[model samples]
Target: MKIPGLSFSLKRAVGITSAKQKIARATGIPTTKQGLERKIGGAILNAVIGRKRKK
Candidate 1:
């Protein structure tokens, strides 16, 4: 899954053992399994909708 705040590929950059910690450090968003899934989904939605795009 991609981190909303980070520019690179998080899945590739982070190791399985430290994924949570790395993600938290990058985004300051702590999450459990389900919570992380939700966050990832939200990130994808935001990307699709261009939430940060300037109109």
Candidate 2:
């Protein structure tokens, strides 16, 4: 998501669909599919927020 090296393509691939399954499909990171969704949301949110805050 927002983490460094995270790509827009990756996020888009995950999309707004099922975060868990999408995250798992996008990233091979090993974790509970459930947690991965939150992780993706948090990471992406953080990045977006960080950017906005900077503005």
Candidate 3:
């Protein structure tokens, strides 16, 4: 399955969310969905792309 611009495994997606949450926690950033997306969208996209290319 595909999610528009994102192409990666569910496990990988979960990892991204976990990493982002960690960053948010360390930096005192809000963990809200929109806030996370705004702060780490590029990192999440890059991670997925890099993982996909490896497989």
Ranking by lDDT: 1, 3, 2
Return the TM-score for candidate 1, rounded to 2 decimals: 0.38
Highest-scoring model, TM-score: 1
> What's the count of clashing pairs in each model shown?
0, 0, 0
Candidate 1 per-residue C-alpha lDDT over 1-55 given as tens digits, one digit per residue, 9 for 90 to 100: 8777868556656666487677878886765777678777878988899785333
Candidate 3: pairs in clash = none
Misplaced by over 4 Å in model 2 are 1-30, 51-55
Off by over 4 Å in 1: 1-27, 52-55
Per-residue lDDT of model 3, residues 1-55, tens digit only:
6579967678566697788678878987767878767557656776878753222
C-alpha lDDT score of every prediction, in listed order:
0.72, 0.66, 0.71
Residue 13, candidate 1: how far off, in angstroms?
33
By lDDT, who's the top model here? 1
TM agreement with the true structure for every prediction: 0.38, 0.36, 0.33
Winner on lDDT between 1 and 3 is 1
Residues forming the 10-long window of minimal summed lDDT in candidate 1: 8-17
Give the C-alpha miss distance for residue 5 in model 1, angstroms: 42
TM-score of 3: 0.33
